[model samples]
Target: MIFVETQYDQTPAALNDLVENAALAALKHQSAPENATVTIVLTDDEQMHSLNLDYLGVDAPTDVLSFPSEEIDPETGDPYLGDILISVPRAANQAESTGHDVESEAQLLTVHGILHLMGHDHAEPEEKERMWQAQAEILTKLGLGNIQVRES
Candidate 1:
């Protein structure tokens, strides 16, 4: 199951569908177990700033943050994939700058976060290429083929 909680009303109605589709795509791409779940939190820049500072020690708000959990929940036995936090404000700005709607930007972030949960990282050159390729393919399948993956 995929859980979506929005602290901001600006989130698009398609948020839940996009998240669930992206999660399924990620799991399929990674050959991960299907008994998995993820939580997506849509929030404003203030909350994002606090979370970024608290977790990553970065004082500024970020587009997305992924907290990957260890596989297999002891209680439910599900492959708990952990949480994904998206800053709606940041995504809006990026969408405007990129000439896309906020929903597409949010979808892109969701895919990126899912890749992270699957252990994809862009910290290294080769890793960035692989991760971006996987993200592009997934986004294309999600009908967001033109969405640009922002470099961090």
Candidate 2:
């Protein structure tokens, strides 16, 4: 199951569909278990900054943050991949500069976060290439082939 929560007051309802489709596409591309679950939370820069500072020791807000989990949910016995938190405001800002809609930016962030939960990291040159390729493939499959996540 894919779950999405929007904490921002101005977040559009359509954002949920974009997030859900992106999450599902990434999971399908990875051949994740049918019982696997992924949760997405959309918020503002303030919440993202707080989470980044508290968990990652960073003082700035990022586009997305993933908390991976390999264990099954005790009550449901379903494999819970993890939680993906996105800053809607951040996504909007990125979309503005990237010449894409916020929905597409949200989808890109969703794919990026799901890749992280699936153990893909871009800390090195080769790893970045591999991860970016995977992102391209997944986005293409989702019909957003032209969308690219800007390097930071």
Candidate 3:
């Protein structure tokens, strides 16, 4: 199952579909289990800053953060992938600078987060290449071929 929540009041109503579709595309590309579950949260920079500081010891706000989990829901027996939190205001700013809309930016972030949850990382040169290739392929399949992930 895929769940989406928005803590910002200015978020669009279509955000749910955007997140779900992006997540589904990533999961399908990765060949994730049929019953895999994940959650996507759209929040503010303040919350992101706090999470970054607390969890990653980074005192700055980031565009997206993924917390990977390996737990299973006893009742449903679904594998809980983890939670993805995105700072909506940051995404808006990135979109403006990247010459794309916030919706497209959010979708890109969604795919990036899902890839992280699936153990794809860009920490090393080879790992980054593989992850970026997979991300590009997934984005292309989602009709977002032009949207590129900015290097941080």
Candidate 4:
């Protein structure tokens, strides 16, 4: 299951169908066990800037942040993947810069965050290759409303 909480003025603050589709795509792409859950939060740059500084030691606003909770929920036994927080304004700018729609950019971030939750990292060359391959595959499966994965 995917739950999204947004605190921004972006109309249609959240897109339920795309979120569900991409999340399910992530789970299926990873062969994740059943009963997995993830939460996505959409806020502004200030919130993300503070979070980035506090956790990553980077005093800058990033497009997205993924916090993976690799433990099972006590009561439900659900594999809680993590939280994906996005800066809506940042995403909008990124989308415009990248020649894509805001929704597409946000979904890409969702795919990236879901990949992180599934233990895919891009800190090293080999890891990056695998992560990009996985992202491409997931996004391809997602077909993301015609937005393709950008080379990273």
When superposed on Cα atoms, how far off is each prediction in RMSD? 1.3, 1.0, 0.8, 2.0
Q: Looking at model 3, report the run of 10 residues with the lowest lDDT sum.
A: 143-152
Task: Point out where model 3 deviates above 4 Å.
Answer: none
lDDT of each: 0.87, 0.92, 0.93, 0.81
Looking at model 3, residue 146 earns an lDDT score of 96
The best candidate by lDDT is 3
**Tens digits of lDDT, candidate 1, 1-152:** 78888898877787767776777877688777778888989899999899999999999999999999987878989989889999988988998999998888888888899899889999999999999999989888888888877695
Per-candidate count of clashing residue pairs (backbone under 3 Å): 0, 0, 0, 0
In candidate 3, how many clashes are counted? 0
For model 2, residues 13-91, the per-residue Cα lDDT tens digits are 7999989999999999988898999999999999999999999999999989999999888998999999999999999
Give me the displacement of residue 119 in model 1, in angstroms: 0.6
In candidate 1, the residue pairs with backbone N, CA or C atoms under 3 Å apart (3 or more residues apart, or in different chains) clash, namely none
TM-score-based ranking, best first? 3, 2, 1, 4
Q: Which portions of model 2 miss their true places by more than 4 Å?
A: none
Clashing pairs in 3: none
- Tell me how candidate 1 scores on lDDT: 0.87
Expressed as tens digits, the lDDT of each residue in 49-106 for candidate 3 is 9999999999999999999999999999999999999999999999999999999999
Ten-residue stretch with the least lDDT total in model 1: 14-23
